[model samples]
Target: MASDKSTASLTTASSKAILLLVVFLLTHTLSFSQTTTRTYLVRLRDKVSSPYSVSRPEQFLSQRSIQRRQKQNIAVLERDLPVNPAYVTQLQQAGAKVRFTSRWLNAVLIEATDATMTAVQRLPFVTGLEFNRALSRPVRSGGRLGAETDTKFGQVQTAINYGTSQTQITQLGVDNMHAAGFRGEGILIGVLDSGFMNADEVSFLKPLFDEKRILATYDFVKKETSVYEDDSHGTSCLAAIAATADGQLYGTAFKASFVLLRTEDADSEQQVEEANWLFGAEYADSAGVDVISSSLGYTTFDDPSQNYTYANMDGKTALCTRAAQIASETGMVVVVAAGNEGSNAWRYISAPSDAAGVLCIAAVNQTGQWASFSSIGPAADGRVKPDLAARGQGTIIGNPDGRIASGNGTSFATPLVAGLAAGFWQANSRLTAVQVVEALRRSGTQAGAPDAQLGYGIPNFARPLATEEPMAPFVVFPNPFSDGEPLTIDWQTINANASVDATLADLTGRTVWQYRYQPGKLGTLTVPSLNLSAGFYVMTIVSGDKRRVIKLLKR
Candidate 1:
């Protein structure tokens, strides 16, 4: 997961004082139980005959969320409906403290004793319960829980002077995107990590408060609104995306709106943190966040039985992976770190990072070389894992004490790519979430030969935006076109009398097929006979000064 340092080992008196207050608040809110307690993920039966309706999505979803779904033409499915409130109340009545409910999964997270869970399972609305975490003693609420470690080595924006941060910003071509006036304005990024620490006090981040860009904050661990006193790890992650200090530092998406969420508990390692991530993801989706940058991951937990193996990285097993998939389906771009486990026993990418459609970021150094510590993977199912790379080593970041620092980890790299996603999407608003993911992949340095190490390699944000209007009038169909079939191009909306030049080139930029045509009244051009071998190819279409680049796979 994306956490660092011993949260309880703070040296500063101010940090200790803050921890005391957090401890006091947690102790007051939580009742101590002498018996062993376990958290269970309660899977609900269904949303049958529920008060909520897909037609009235406004009742359950925020207007912005509704608009995003509508914009993507995504239907509000039954699974999107809220879990029955009656079920939650029943669980509470049965002595289970309901912590969170996931609309997409139709489940609730509750902390309960075995006896209480027995009562909870008997409820007619309950389908099943999965054991998450067991607590032998009283709950460990404060002082960093979970181990998603990233080494401190570190640690910028656009026309906004990115002093020490310039290299990172330009490495991904984010500077060009910003120069094009797409510095993530109007985009909402939800950051899920351990804590924000003194985000409000950081000079570069104060604008988030002054400009009211911080739309919300939540501590899933403590069940509170305050996330400012937990850990400094998240402060650095946020700095990668939102910090703005001219010539000193700048985040890729400094102008974007934000919602800070504390999902990783830095003090303990447990499956419950994954559940917390699910809750945070659900919250981000409901809040209409355009992108989610989570630097956390789960692998081995405190309980050996709860540990995830490489097989579990298949994207279908981990709870957080499922949440990532659902969040992407809901029109939110999900970005996560590709664990810093390289050179370790478990060098594979972590869960949620393995989730398909999510951009799993790997770490690269100042010169764009792969960081030996950045995780590597073929996912467990043999799919390219680390979807992109970004500068992480010695990356510039803002500190809680109102200073700057350098850090190292896939943790920092993850948010830089997330920031790029926001700015790229803002510049190309017509693209769907999936399209956004693909555009970034296509812009990668190794897009044509993506592998486990760096997946598609580092992405150049300007590459995609500079290439074409993703939703242009021209359309190419049967994307993975089967061999021997005609390749059709529909330019129905293009200029009627304009001559179009279409060239299909192999991955190495070798033009294998070329077609020149003036559209018929119908504006359809078909290449009836192409004797090309099966492989990946790039197609460039030029009609006057307007050009479009398309990647194609022939089978």
Candidate 2:
């Protein structure tokens, strides 16, 4: 009886040991599987209980953003609200790590294991889940980690001159606009790019920080405030618009307010970056930016299967293109690079640039000829792409280290055009966003016959300000007059017997000077002395009921 009891005990101990071993193996295998992470796009059902409202846009949007929409008569809609916090919390609770959230697409980017993904999908709030890409080691181009280091600082020039940038600004007639006292004052521009390393440290951009003109900044890749710490691509692009060193380099809209956004992941090419761009655009819209300048483009990715074909260049196909169109519809002028694929196998314009209503900028040389590297296009939908052209080849840019360097790519041209647009908008604040785009297109040198290579050719800022009817009943010689100099006016009274009532007002319509003249004939009237600050102004001449308002530029 004792031997039989001992045998039973030994058998029970062996069984328990086997059970313990099996459990250990199973747990190890589960942990190994969980360690391999994959990225996915989590599509949420709705933002049902969002902590924002369209009626009270001030709660979510900046005062400038609300003002921009109001200026263009764009209404605040429910789509502008933030995503529901509850949905995000529920997602986090399911063991999935959420990276970025895009309210425009109503989606969230998450990283998780297969089991976690299954759990997330089973949740009621998750409408669908699409595999994005595997989260492996970043495949950086040239195997470099951070932004390319600046080696051109040693080649700095001593003179404070525009250097190679003269042709670019002068070619677009922006020089004339600058002389006319319109240098993007009161205009807000948003820059969306990969990174802006040393942007805050650059000498040319010092005024932006000092004046607090940099309204906002966000990094969609790391989901942090490290926009200025990333790649230098964005810094180069921003220099084309906001750099304000007197001679070394002057960006197109140097005086414009800026909202910098880092939307690209320079480490890898993926579809998530497109979502990042959409999020950036939505943020810019809510911040009340007037123009969005993006030098980033998409075509191929690190994953072969995720590569976009030429057909995807259609305005409505790419995710970024759709977002850009939505941005334009929301009353902000969208400017994008036409891509630098002219000599490559994929020689075509990229997304967002193909989107209609957005000003797609192509690259050109100083002589106004198409750059060999400039992307060619008639968008897949047959719309004329690259609505305008600007200097891109050998374009001058302010390096992050305070040196001026020349870069070649449509990337440089996009900001030049964006700054020009801002200056034009500043000159004519009464024009609607759509009207501003149309005026720009119409003012192009080749407006009558536009081609894919050069679009409407280079835009001339003076063309848009030229009207069919005379600006006023009188003409002012040397219209952009120096502050201490006398102004010569050639006037002709509309009513022979009526006296002439003349008033000079600033751009804000505040009367700065008033003069009443007796019944005047067709003759030149010289004002001996006039004191006015440098800016744009309006001179109104009233002859009885016939009043004429003419635009005036003060130096």
Which stretches of model 1 miss by more than 4 angstroms? 1-34, 131-160, 464-555
Candidate 1 Cα RMSD after full superposition onto the native fold (Å): 14.0
C-alpha lDDT of candidate 2 relative to the true structure: 0.80
Taking all chains together, the TM-score of candidate 2 against the true structure is: 0.78
- Model 1 scores a TM of 0.77
Superposed Cα deviation of residue 508, candidate 1 (Å)? 24
Which tens-of-lDDT digit does each residue in 442-517 have in candidate 1? Answer: 8899898988889999998645323566566776776656667888877766677788888987644678888788
Q: All candidates' lDDT scores?
A: 0.82, 0.80
Model 1 lDDT-worst window of ten: 137-146
Off by over 4 Å in 2: 1-33, 49-51, 130-138, 141-161, 464-555
| Per-residue accuracy of model 2 over 1-555 as CA lDDT, tens digit each | 899999999999999999999999999988889777777778788878788778898987889888888887889876777778888888899998988777667788788888888899899988885434453334542111112333342223423355556778888888888877788988989999988999999898999999999988999888887688888888888998988766557888888999999888888877777777888999898888899999988887776676778888889888788889989988999999998888889899987799998999998888998998788988987888879999888777877777877788888899999999999888767667897898789778898899989888899776533433445556776776776678777766466667777788764457889887776554556655676665556677676666666666665
The lDDT leader among the candidates is: 1
